[model samples]
Target: MHKSQEKIPFWRVKKLNQMNSEEWESLCDGCGKCCLEKLEDLNTEKISYTNIGCELLDVDKCRCKNYAKRDHYVPDCVRLSSANISSLKWMPSTCAYKLLSEGKNLPNWHPLVSGNTDSVHEAGMSIRGRAIAADDAGDYEDHIVQWPK
Candidate 1:
């Protein structure tokens, strides 16, 4: 079959745990919502997103400055492997990983669907230009936002 006529690939067909590393990594839409610091209500157990991104996250680009060494730089950073995907309740509604975990299809703005890395930013789904670096954050509670939650 021609390259254009080839199948759409298995993101829509395969389960999250069944995907290979490259396929799994490609699922990230670069929304940067996961890079933000989150707050949880001790009483209600509700998770709230913050506009304060991690120190290493490039707020303008919506990407980590040191992705390969992110865990080394920030020990507390939660690694989103297949094993932990189902347990993360704080992921944004637009997150590809979370959507797939919930058995939902990816959105049209996703890079995998749009075939453009900038689609997430263009669709206004990314944290670009909307978040502050954690280094500049004053108080976690003050930075709480409802958009990505």
Candidate 2:
């Protein structure tokens, strides 16, 4: 009889704060929703996602054009980490960080669970090919969308 190997699920076993740098980084599902511009209502404190992507976002690849220097280019860009996870209320509900922080499991489309990097795009979760570049976008209010929710 052939021996069967047990697979260990890292996310289930490890707390978000316990993850190493690589593991923490890998938790990102590459959905690119975080790269989209958001508008906050001053009165209601509600955040709305816009289809107009950040200047550094590569819409097709759903990756940043300059990952290393993103903060330098976009001073307001919020860096997501375990410590600041709770403050990311504007992040997409489908975002892996938000899910994990809420003690929920990763979606099937997440690369860590799907074992394929393109699974997020295949699941129609990524902003790829759908978002307009911030430079080309006219009005933020006009570009508001409900998909990122």
lDDT of each: 0.89, 0.90
lDDT of 1 at 29: 93
Model 1 per-residue lDDT tens digits across residues 37-105 = 888899999988899988889999899999999999999999897789888878787889888888889
Off by more than 4 A, model 1 = 1-6
Residue 118's lDDT within candidate 2 is 96
Give the candidate number with the greatest lDDT.
2
Clashing pairs in 2: none
Candidate 2: segments with Cα more than 4 A from true spot: 1-5
